[model samples]
Target: MAKVKHESRWYPLESGESVLDGLLRQGVSVPHSCRAGACQSCLMKAVGGAVPQAAQVGLKETLVAQGYFLACTCRPPEGTELEVAGAEALRVPARISSLSFLAPDVLRVRLVTDAPFDYRAGQYVSLVREDGLARSYSLASLPREDALELHVRVIPGGAMSGWLAAEAPLDQRVFLQGPAGSCFYVAGRPDQPLLLAGTGTGLAPLYGIVRDALEAGHTGPIWLFHGARTPAGLYLRDELRQLADRHPQLRYRPGVLAGGTRDIAEGPLDALIRAECPKPVGWRAWLCGDPQLVLSLRKKLFLAGLSLKDLHADSFLPSTPQVGASPAAAGAR
Candidate 1:
């Protein structure tokens, strides 16, 4: 079993135990959520031993070179030593700039930071409250936008979302960590057909990605689909429609599983998408939203001739917090 050294103390891991579990078993106060290694809240560093390559997956090369690894996924070799990273090193302070409702249950949050924060659109950041509660939200604003925008779907008992929607004061300072994820738009394929699909606030990243592509002067045919159970679940319809109208290369399709209207299609969203693009051989697709839906669409797109290399996905998992309820659960992948 590997031994984890943290703050001058050593903890022994049981057979097949992860570094996070080993420390938590010994009553260590490590911040973590979405134990599946998606949230990246339990990030740590290996100072005296080699970290497992799997634990470094999805992390930036700079962080990996600096010895950072996800504790939740770390299961080092026998006799390996590690260290817990300080929270201060991983968080940057930002202040809330504005808030508004985009839908009945979705809140649009804008934040600004004096710190030099650089991020690509469609990436995600973890918002950490004063009390140590953290939840990941994706960026809906472009990099050049004046403020960072996040579309938060308020869950009934979500601690982070509820606080942001009801209690958080404007100008309240909060810590922001990470701008991870590779779902952002990449320029250079100006003429490649693009397909983007998302559900709920999953549209947040897709929204940013669409604008980013257009800003980069992409002349490709871009098809964007946003799905919801009802029309109320869909927001920004007019704004997206106006955008599509201004850009002849763009098309916006909004649909509902029920309550079909003259403007909105009614059917299984995945089926609707597949019917529209029966042969996606030369298409570059970006899928975001519920894990199950993203998984389904990924498989379908792959089977329909879309290359896996051209398909990017960011799947948000519902957070099952041990401390407090979080909206949309954990990791806005």
Candidate 2:
């Protein structure tokens, strides 16, 4: 028998039962999704007692260093003490400024915080609605921008997406938690060729990161691959094309799955990247959008010569009870 602590309450952790399961059994509504640990929706911090190393697997170094572990995977020993993160450290109060359709299925949302909030371009934040349901969305706006921008794709039957698309009102106040993940571009790597790829709305973070790189005066060639199932699914196509035309160092390639359009490359997005840059030995890669695409491309790019250290990604898992399938408004991003 083990006493597991969350907040001020103590719950019994039966032997062989996971922390998430035990907590849920006690009616403790700790947010969680993908109970297998891939979504990071059940993240918890150890307040006292030793945290099992296995519980922190696949977490970012910064999170691991901060004593954060996934509750869904935590099979702790007896007497383990835990604490859910406080809202203050993880949440920022903000209000929605405006929402616009980027595509038939995608909406661009902007949020203005009460105070200055700092975050890298490629990081993501969890948007919590009035009902207490929350969903993760990548920030498409840069830190210097006046408002936080998120590109959301409507997913069929998704609660948060449906709410944002049909129910959320203007000037709505929402709590935003996080700017987490280490997939952003850093200044020191200016000389390294950057390869960015995404499917559907995955372009949100990739768009922000690309702008950040350009603003930092990156001298190396910068390539971006955006893929969609059809031309109508491609949001910001004209804008990205204009950006490419303006920056000689930047290259934008649009990939389409069904029809072979002259303006867009035909094939899977990962295949598009493979064809463009066969040897990515010294390149740094950023991938977002669908989880399968991100995972498969990560492996493929690594095998194609990109250093494992140089590759970064944010996989949007399908939205579940406590987990979000990133960019919940349209296509995978």
Maximum-lDDT candidate: 1
Looking at model 1, residue 62 earns an lDDT score of 90
Give lDDT tens digits, candidate 1, residues 1-333: 678888889889987788887887887777676677777766677777788899999898998988888888988777776665545587889999999999998899999988778999999888887766778889999989889999998876677787888999999998888988888888988999999999999899999999999999999899999999999988999999999999999989998999989999999889889878789898999999888999999999999999999999888876655433334443332
Q: What is the C-alpha lDDT of each candidate?
A: 0.85, 0.81
| lDDT (C-alpha) at residue 205 in model 2 | 94
| TM-scores, one per candidate | 0.93, 0.87
Question: What tens-digit string does per-residue lDDT give for candidate 2 at 1-333?
Answer: 766877788888888788888887887766554566655556777766666898898777887887888888888776665555423355678999998889999989999999788799989877777545656788999999999999988867667677778888989998876666787998896778999999888999999999999999998999999989988888999999998898889999999998868898888888788889999998999999888899999999999999989999888876544323344333222
Q: Which ten residues in a row have the lowest lDDT in candidate 2?
A: 324-333
Q: What is the lDDT of residue 171 in candidate 1?
A: 99
